[model samples]
Target: MISQSAGKIFLAEERGHNELNWFRSFNTFNFGSFYNEHKHPFESLYILNEDTLAGNRKISMLAENDSCIVLIPVVGAISFKDSAGNSGLLQAGQAQVLNVYAGTTLEISNPYEEESVNFLQIWIKTPDLQSTVPQLFEFDLDKNPNQLLELFSPQKKTLVKTVPQPHGVIGKFSGRSEAVYNPAQSGNALFAYVIEGNVEVQYRLMNPRDGLGLWDLEEMELEALSENAIVLILEIPVLKTV
Candidate 1:
């Protein structure tokens, strides 16, 4: 078994508001610019943006080969429009995955006459999608199994059809997550960022306004000891090199 750290602990901080008038809410720090150069190809397992859109306002469809995308809502509910002309509403505890194959436009809107919606957008690297179609899996609070949430996955097709096992799951632990990584999970890397509460990771404790760096490792764990402790964990598959 490959033994190593679970990686480090860090916190997710709010950046600012987005430029879109229709897309309201706090634009998170991880919301990277299109112009910004990326260091590791899929290393940037996530590009986040907490969005709050106005009624009837529409967001442009966005996609990048650089990553697989997932959306999580903190408050309010949002609907999406895809190239397949598919549309649906995603509520709190609801996770949406974006498959940007050959690029598709995604229009996000909140049309409820009473409430405004807030959500978080997360991007990760896509696994090999050869001869497979894009996928989506949803978990609702009423039926959600654990304290965690599985919002999206691009590898679901390959995992379900071939291995009978799924790659990894990104869960939001309100206070603290049982930071547990499996050894059987071969060819993967771990990333965790605190969005709400503080977490003690190994000997390193992290609070708001901090970020932990990671690379090839074995296993990592996280613990949040207080109320409202929110953490976003990204399990990115390490790309095999030649």
Candidate 2:
């Protein structure tokens, strides 16, 4: 049995909120002015921000060196353009990853006329920068229900492999459905986020927007508590503190 000491739960309500006239964001870690010493980067998983943009609204962010940025649209399509001359639209069922250098300005905007768009922006620190272009992965949850669908894997040639690669998966399960996840690499950590419905991970209940981090375990079990429950799991390598 995996001990409870290997898990840490982060409640949704405890997240930092930044609201403006056209943009609203809930940060799970230190981002912008929302700094929490207790909420530091979970291993190499640096940032996880849930952002909502009003119609025709836009926001810009500067990229850090030796980092990878991943964007997942949750509600509506979002248009993005980076200073490196890359631009595209990310739909609800799609995920995009881009290895960016320092000082790259990324502009993300809601393309809808009257509807708001919600998306998740995740940042991961890499050992070194790689010369790779932006890549998009699309998956349909309805196509394969009650199973984990892999969204991103480090095995791709486009991804940097200077260090242990991170893997990402998304799953949709019905009530009473059960699933298990085993990390591809040893000594890696797992971070699970509830996207739509409630779920129980390793005996801990989690609501929508809640996140749970676990380490020092070989595998973890998950069970959906509601219909059409969606969860995002990231297998991140444990990095040593410098």
Identify the leading candidate in terms of lDDT: 2
In order, candidate lDDTs are 0.54, 0.87
Give the residue spans of candidate 2 off by over 4 A: 158-162
TM-score computed on alpha carbons, candidate 1: 0.71
Number of clashing pairs per prediction, in order:
12, 0
The local lDDT score (0 to 100) that residue 74 gets in candidate 2 is 97
- Give a tens-digit lDDT track for model 2, residues 45-123: 9889999999998999987756678899999999999988888999999998877777889899999999999999988
User: Candidate 1 lDDT, tens digit per residue, 133-219?
Assistant: 445565654344224555454453355443222233444444544656442355556555555556654446767434454556566
Candidate 1 Cα outliers beyond 4 Å, as residue runs: 1-17, 20-46, 130-136, 140-157, 160-178, 208-213, 240-242
Q: Which ten contiguous residues of candidate 2 have the minimum total lDDT?
A: 154-163
